[model samples]
Target: MLIDKPLPELRRYRGRNPRPADFTRYWREALRELDATPVQPELVPNREIDVPGVECFDLWFTGVGGARVYAKYLRPKAPIGRRHPAVLQFHGYSGNSGDWLGKVPYVAAGFCVAALDCRGQGGRSTDAGAVQGNTLNGHIIRGLDDPDDRKLLFRSLYLDTVQLARVVMSRPEVNPDRLGAMGASQGGGLTLACAALEPRIRRAAPVYPFLCDYQRVWEMDLAKDAYAELRDYFRRFDPCHEREADVFRKLGYIDCQHLAPMIKGEILMYTGLMDQICPPSTQFAAYNHIRARKEMVLYPDFGHEWLPGEADRTLRFMLPLAR
Candidate 1:
């Protein structure tokens, strides 16, 4: 409620960002390109961390634009021929996959966990830098000036998630039918993208997701922190606001709200009503468009930070996948 619309109004808000006229065709072509690219997955054993009842590895795969993507993979030791459930964990903006110990809780429950390190961020993943545009500030506007919309950095990042999911699902010990995805902030947005592009994901939990309703964030004047790149992009490139609508329309291809309708997995979204970083209305914009079975948990007084007990709630929400 802090600067956003009231809770009731937020629930009814669809979004203000424009969806590209070729949205579906655009994504279909992206998927086809991903399909053509060889995953070339490699899992190198991590000999440093010794956790009882679990095996760990540094997973690497080739993503679109030939960038080498990385992820932390952990699987519970199980009887031969037994396949277990798996979860894909994406990290926040500018963060790498977290410590291996953080993923043990899922492994302890007879599940496999793969934490992705988004390309070009604070991780081992390599950025191909193939796009033609201002790469000065953030990935959100990485390819804004390119004639080809597919050059957008986020387009590649979103495909990386799907490719990772496919590699994880191909593992002999993982049950493809029981895969789930979760993350917060930028990671949360990726979770939605992964689920939308790979419909086989059984469940998805996105916590106060970023990369949603860009125009809404700009209009609300809440684009300063995590979304600061928006302001920087305008100041450096289109200071006169002449290309505002065009810029936002191009961004629509990467917006989570536009992808929400394509998600087939059951979704459990978390939102902090008082959040200013990713305002409540912006979060609701994506949440409201989800056509899948879904639920939203709101914190009346919380901001964009931690939501007490969210970890436990997410664990319980995803527990059904193990069965």
Candidate 2:
């Protein structure tokens, strides 16, 4: 089923959401706040997960709004007096970073790996939320009622990605110039955000990313799954569509599509055309805006879930950072 525009049209789709007039300035100020925020990073060794050649730790750092962000860090136990490349991983929406064993292969291949557990999700990271509105299902709608756009939950989450990279780069044994990021779904959105915010990120791989063009997703009526909260928010709060324009305008501040042009890293994005969850065009809306060296892998037969061999392909694509 063709869920979006044909591939050719998808290539040219800029996005349906309007970019706020102060979009650039808004992000600059947000980044400035991150710059001023002190990330008191702490790394505690996880003795139970250690292997002969790999070391694991529970990584924590202070993020925007003073949230204590969490991640799983792994590195080669014995580096041969040389710096190693690093990879940042973000998990799907509402999910924690997976077990330490999942990150071993990268460490085995001589790269330091850090996987983030998004704040307030099913993880150790602190949300530190003080929003004015709905505290329900969606992070998308969180703090929408606040007069301050900076209070948006995803804004803080996006900043957390950059904070994690900053923390990772500060390590003595990691190569600052060879950093990469990867994730699927919400994590994929974050991968793009992280690379866009931190231009030093050398590469990024985002598979079927969520949180792109919010209005487009609503128009396509694909807002019932991972985006169910978008629909729910409307049903309960604005049943007459009286606040439609205002709502989307607020969401524009955190949209990944708006952030794509700022990315300098080489991007390898994956999309499944049959995807009903995030929808294919929503993914392309962000991808088409990326001006850096980029490529897309299309799965005409797949959806938002598994696209076979994607894990191996991503591993190979990012492995070059270690070179």
| Number of the predicted model whose lDDT against the real structure is largest | 1
Predicted model with the maximum TM-score: 1
On residues 198-239, what C-alpha lDDT tens digit does candidate 1 reach at each position? 999999999999999999999988779889999999999999
Question: What lDDT does the true structure give each of the candidates?
Answer: 0.93, 0.90
lDDT of 1: 0.93
TM-score of each candidate structure, all chains considered together = 0.97, 0.96
Judge candidate 1 at residue 105 and give its lDDT. Answer: 97
Model 2's alpha-carbon lDDT is 0.90
User: How well is each residue in 208-227 modelled by candidate 2, as lDDT tens digits?
Assistant: 99999999999998888788
lDDT of 2 at 265: 95
Error of 1 at 44 (Å): 0.8
Give candidate 1's TM-score: 0.97
lDDT of 1 at 233: 92
Model 1 poorest ten-residue lDDT run: 128-137
